[model samples]
Structures are given as structure tokens and as C-alpha cells.
Target: MNKKKYQIFISSTYKDLITARNKAMETILGLYQFPIGMEMFSADDSEQWEVIKQTINLSDYYIILIGHRYGSLTQEGISYTEKEYDYAKECKIPILTFIQDRNVPTTTDEREQDPSMSIKLNNFIDKVSATKMCDFWKKPEELPGKIAIALVKAFTANPQIGWTRVKGEKLQAVSSELAETISENRKLREKIEELEKLLVTQKPVLSVSLNSNDPIELTVPTLPSPSKYPQLLRRDHIPAHLTPYITDYDITSYNNSLPSKEEFEEYNKNTRYYHLKKASIDFDISIKNDGKLKAKDIFVTIELPDFVEVQDKFDSYKNVLPKNPIPKSLLEKAKEKYIKDNNIKPKTSFGVTGGLVALGSIIKPYSLEFSSTYDDIIPHLTKSQSINSWSSVKDKTITINVKNLIHTRQKTFDDFVLLPLKAGSGFINISIICEEYDEAENYTFPINVSK
Candidate 1:
């Protein structure tokens, strides 16, 4: 296989950082890639800007170098360097920015002398730095190493369609093989037509079993318990010890501290803990080839009734939580309640000169540990040689493509299907279609579901 070479476009001010641009180009060339720049084109020419955009469009990556002085401005008052950067971004090209360190020493000629130009340079620097990660370069000697590393990282992270060389003889060889294949296919079709005329009707030998039997027993999944979710519980459950100290003020405060009904309902609906707490069961489906001849291109589709739902074993709640389980707002509210109940006066210290305040001892708020227990069941669905792929659910039907099954071979998909059924009774219909038989094999299983 031929290795792909990426074309990187270098954008920078010509007068101030010409040496830096050249170094960047050499770095890309050293990596066995192509480097594109505007050294050949006139910077002030209007026609050249269009060509520059076209070149940038063709580039796989973009590298921009920023120094003390902004490059020559276009008719829109934006620098040519900034214009190229903007165009590259509009084209969706991966860009690497290198801005010169402000603390670095430079000659007067290298820095922008005009106040207005200096402001524009600062604004441009701020724009690039605020948007993306930029490397700071104090010297032109640092360009090659920084450019090489950033380019390598970009190449790995955001790969693009790069250039590859192809030989003309390869195309000709492929054409010859295609012609030979066509001729062989024509002869095989004639033989198949003659064999079809003498063949008799045959029945499919593939058999499907749910849990190694016809009818599958399904049950409604149990809903999550309210006790497991303390957030949804009533907040009026006060401790017996605090009853003597409880006042009407405290009762009113506790009542107002409860989360809004809407917020509570939303949290209950969205939290992964609540969703995963519901218990689910997985059932296995086994397919066997009972014929002497092999079965090819086998497809098994199971049509489920409205009372039952089929889910993948891997399906579960995918919500990502923060490192800290407790919200800061809740913690703050708890701290305020603790301070109010203890009657602790928070003291503030003023400095001698009245310019600053002294730090006070930190208040360690009372801690309450919260935890919940629920069953998290994940079925083991192992890969089988007879199974190819499972199509997405459509119209309550799941289509599973089975690999070529040899004679008398049986493959079991362990815990491959989950039937979360409603409280009702129904029949699941299964159809198996293969190339070895003239008709599709059909089977039906009665299911009784209950809570």
C-alpha cells in the first residue's frame, strides 16, 4: 500500500517572520510531505488572493505563525495573514497556530511601530488565542520542532484525504480481471438455469428455538423502588432527637427547602440510576441447520407483538455523572441549615490598615452519607461464528443475518434478546430465509407476560 502524503499550507507575515515560514516549510518536507505557501504570489494583488484561497482549499492542514507585526491588510482592513486563517477555518481545515512570545526581545523594525497597527495585532492575537490552543515561540529556531510535533498530533487526531500515487498499469490489470469475471458469470448463469428446470420444491432445514423451546415465558420488569431514590422521598421525616428544638420557623424553612415538583419529576425521568434500577431479563435464541447441505445467506427475522419489546443486552442508561455526586447547591443549603440550628455566629476579621480582611477558621458542616441499593443486571451476549450482524429495530421486527451454516451445525446466541413485555399474552412469529431452500421456514411461540 502506498503511504499518503498530506499538503500543509503555511500562513504568516512575509516581512517579519519570513525565516519562521521557511523553517515551517522545511519541517513539513522533512516528514515526507508537501508544503504550500504564498511566497511566489504578490501579497497585494487581488487576483492572487483568489488563487491563495483555492490553494488553501486543496491543503490537508493549515499552519499559521503570528509575530509582533500584523501582515499587510486587504480591502476589508483585515490582514492577509488573518484572511488566510479565516478562509482556512471556513474551509474546515485543521489549523495549528504559533504566536510569538510577548516577553521575547525583538528589534524596532520587527515590531509594529504604528499605534493603530499594534492594536490590530493585539486584537488578532487575542482572537486566535481565545478560540484554539496556540504554541508560544520566542525564537524562529523553535518553529521546525513545534511545527513537526503539532502537525503529527493533528495528522493522528484529524485525518484528511491525502494524496497517493497510482500507476496506469494497475487500472488496466483491474479491467482485464473484470472482463474475465463477466465471462465466467455468464457461463455459470446458463448452468444454473438448466439445473433449476430439473429441481423439485424443497423445504428449509433451519430451525429456531427460543430458550431451547418454542414458547418463551416473559414477565414485566419491576419498577425502581421509591426508597432507593431518597431525592424523591418526602423531606418531612425529621429525627426524633431534634423534635424538642423544632419550631414553626424550622418547619417553614424545611418545607421551602424542598426541590420543585417539576424539577423532581425531570430528575426522576432523566437520571440513569432510576432507569438502571428497573430489572430486565434476557432470553437466548438458538438456530440449527438440520440438512445435509450447507445453508448460505441465512436471515432470521422475529416479529414481536405490541405487548412485548425486544432490546439489546448492551442497552442501558448512559448518563455520565460528575466526580462529586453531591451538588454544590445542596451542600451549601445543608451548611446554612446547620449554622442556623447551632446558632453559630460567623465572625469577620478586618486588617489593621483596613485594606484587607484576615482569614477565619473554616466551618466543617455536618455530613450525611447517602447511598442506594438496586440490582444492575447485564446479560452476557457472546459472539458466535454463525451470526453476522443484527439490524436495527423497525416496525417491531428484528432482522438478524446468520453466517453460512455447515451441515448439522448449531449456533446459540446466548442472552441475545430481551423481551420487556407488558401484562398480557401474545405470540412471537419467526421466519427463517436461506438460499439453500425454496421456501422460508416459519415458527410461532406463545408468550404469557405478567408483572
Candidate 2:
């Protein structure tokens, strides 16, 4: 196992069932014999929404502690549970939901009085479930072992998943604010009760010097560390697995350089990085409100005329969209550009292109659901790999299998392919993921089939 550990954020509507949720978390930690990386909120601490996001950002896995009435309304608007899940999705963090057997909210004739709340509640539950996350829906006694197994599987897949989920304040900002506010209210009462006592210590929580809860500040001026502060933060401490494929990287310069949260969020142009000479490129397609944060089903594609070739300039295709959803003419232009630019194109085949057919089916009911996923490498016909699932990844090596794949209705996470490179492959090709294909008994690449 790699010496590096995982940080996971245990997120839920913590107010409603803190005891059961904390016990489940404790059981999970105890089962693992208490690794140094794992952390969870106490009953007194769960009400703070900002703290939850910070925990989520610090963690690799957003362990949603799902029970009845997941602690949203009590905290006020901006459910941290949803925020963490959405942000984690935005950040590409894996989610593992642990559902307790409390009856999930459903509508009945008597309950129809507040059908709106019921509808909202069910929608929230559905959104959380839609991620197709690994779940633990068992009795309290059965939860410990199940949680342990899931963590082990997820950790064996990637220690970073656990490590990054619970690291910083940015993860907890929105979620913990409500909790912190509640904490202050309780503190104010305590302070009133003990007004006669001589105060001995400086209060860090009430100090106005620091910014809001998000620990990962884009502002350099605010990131000053105390003398005893750990100078370097490992992936476990960085909150949320920002880069899912790679094992470790440095953020000192980015921390020192960026101006604010918005600036440091993501770069506009495509950026490239190398892990021991294996090439990886990264570019963010802005998140949409249509409940998708993945690479597939993105509306726009920009091609630098020189960088991309085939039919025509990508700019020309913009006018054709969203009405004529599949731009076959544009793809034809792109194919021409690919052939012209690469020069070593495949010989003319009798069959039509799969890319065209794939795009054409987007509007056919479920056809467009998870199309156009991201891939690190340009997909080729000869060979490919599908990631049904992955177990803890250590030092850049992820144990991947083809059987763990689950259908996701969203475009996020399904965009990248999981390639299990062999030992001695030199560097890990940690690329953008894509979930583009259906499960098949046998699949041959360049899948050009003709009638």
C-alpha cells in the first residue's frame, strides 16, 4: 500500500440523525482500525454546513450519510448535501452513498397536504441516487462491514478518493455556514450563562481576519500559514479528488499565484501535463443546469483550425446546432480535417462512420443520455478498455476491472475510459475519462460494420 492516505468527507443533513450517522461513521473507522486519514463530524459539529463542504473538498469520497429527511430544510436554503454532491461532481470526485433503512420520503394521500415538500424531497433523493454511486443500504449492525468493504474497494481503487474528500474549508463553506451559525447560537447562550468567568483563550471562530469557510482560497494574501503549519499538503489534505487519475502533484504556485476563488477555479484553455512522459490534457467544459457535469452531452466543441481537421472549421458548425442536434455535415468536415492533417489515414472503407451514427441518435429517447464522453486518448478501433469499476489506486497505479461499470444517466464521470496499463509501462497515462460504449460480450475497435 502507498504511504499516502485518504481524506473522506462524511456529508449528510447531519442535524436530523446525527447519532445514527456518526455511529455508522465510527463503525466504519473502527472496522478500518482507524487509519490516520479518516475523519468525521461529531454530533455537536454536524449542523455546520460550511464545515461539511470543507470536509467534502478535503475528501476523495463524498460519503453521503443518507437517512430519512436528509438534513436540508433545517439548515435553510442551499442544501450542503446537494452542494457537496454537485461540487464533487464538478470536481470529478467519486461518491459513495450509505443509505440507512429509514423510509425514504414518498407521497401518500394524507401526505399530499405538503406534496410540494414531498416532491422536493424525492427530487433531492433522486438527484443523489442518480450519480449511480456505490451504496450501503443495510441495518445498523450490517453497516460497519459494508462500509468497510466499500471503503476498501474504493481505497484499493484510489487512496486519494478517501484522502482528498475531507481536507479543507472550501469544501465546507456553504454547508458548514449553517452549522457554524447554529454553533454560535449555542455558544452565545453558553457565553451568557458564564458571563462571570474570566476568558483565557483567543477565539479562532469569531475572528474577522480570515475569509469564509472554503479552505482552498484562490487569494494568495489569505493563505498565510502559521509556523507549525504543515508546509506541504498531500492529496488527502487537499479536499476532493480534483485530478482523479494522477497520484500526486504540487499546488504551492497556484496557491501563491491566483487572485481569488473564481480565478483559480479552472483554466480557460486546454492544459497539458506529463507523468513520466505519458501525455495528459485537461480542459473544462462548463457545467450546465441540466443535471450533468461529465464530459458527454456537452453542447459545444471548439476546434483550432490548425489543430483540428476533417470537414470544416468548428466555428462553422455552431450555427447548425442545437436545433439540428447532430451535425453530420460538420463531422464529415472534421473527418476530412483528420485525414488531411494526419496524412496517414486509414484506407476508404465500405462502412459509414460510427461517430456520425452515435451523434445522430442523441434525440432518440434514451439515446442521448450518456453520449460524447471524454477520453484521454483519441479512441481507436483496434483496442479499448472500459472501466466498470476501480479499486484503491496507490502511487498512480489503479486496479481496474471491466465488470464494475454501472449505467449513469448523467454525462459526468462516464466520459473517461479506464485503461489498466501493464507493469513497466513507464508513466501512467492519467487522461480524461469517457464512458461511451455499452457492455458487450466482445467488442472490436474501429467498429465499422456494413450491411
**How many clashes show up per model?**
0, 70
Q: Write the per-residue lDDT of candidate 1 for residues 1-451, one digit (tens) a residue.
A: 2288999898888877888988998898999999989867887899998899899999999889999999778999989989998898899998899999998999997899999999999999988887564799999998888888898888888889998765699878878899999999999999998776545323337898887784566666565443222252233554443344456565555556665666655565544342332434555677798875677888888888887666655543222321222233332344455556776555564332122122244433212211121123223334443336444556678776776777688767653455554687778899998887677878888877777
Candidate 1 shows a clash count of 0
lDDT of 2 by residue, 1-451 (tens): 4344565556666545556566666855664433211224433345654665555566666566665553334344545466566777887777777665535453342122455665665777777766665564644566666767777777677556233234467767856987899999999989876763422221111111011212211111121122121233344543232233223333443234334433322221111111111211111111122222222321222121111112111111111112212113322344455445555334254334533222333335432322343231234312223343222323423222333222222212222212112112121122122233222112111111111
Off by over 4 Å in 1: 168-451
lDDT of 1 at 151: 81
Off by over 4 Å in 2: 1-3, 31-51, 74-78, 101-114, 136-138, 161-451
Q: What TM-score number comes out for model 2? A: 0.30
Compare the candidates by TM-score and give the number of the best one: 1
TM-score of 1: 0.38
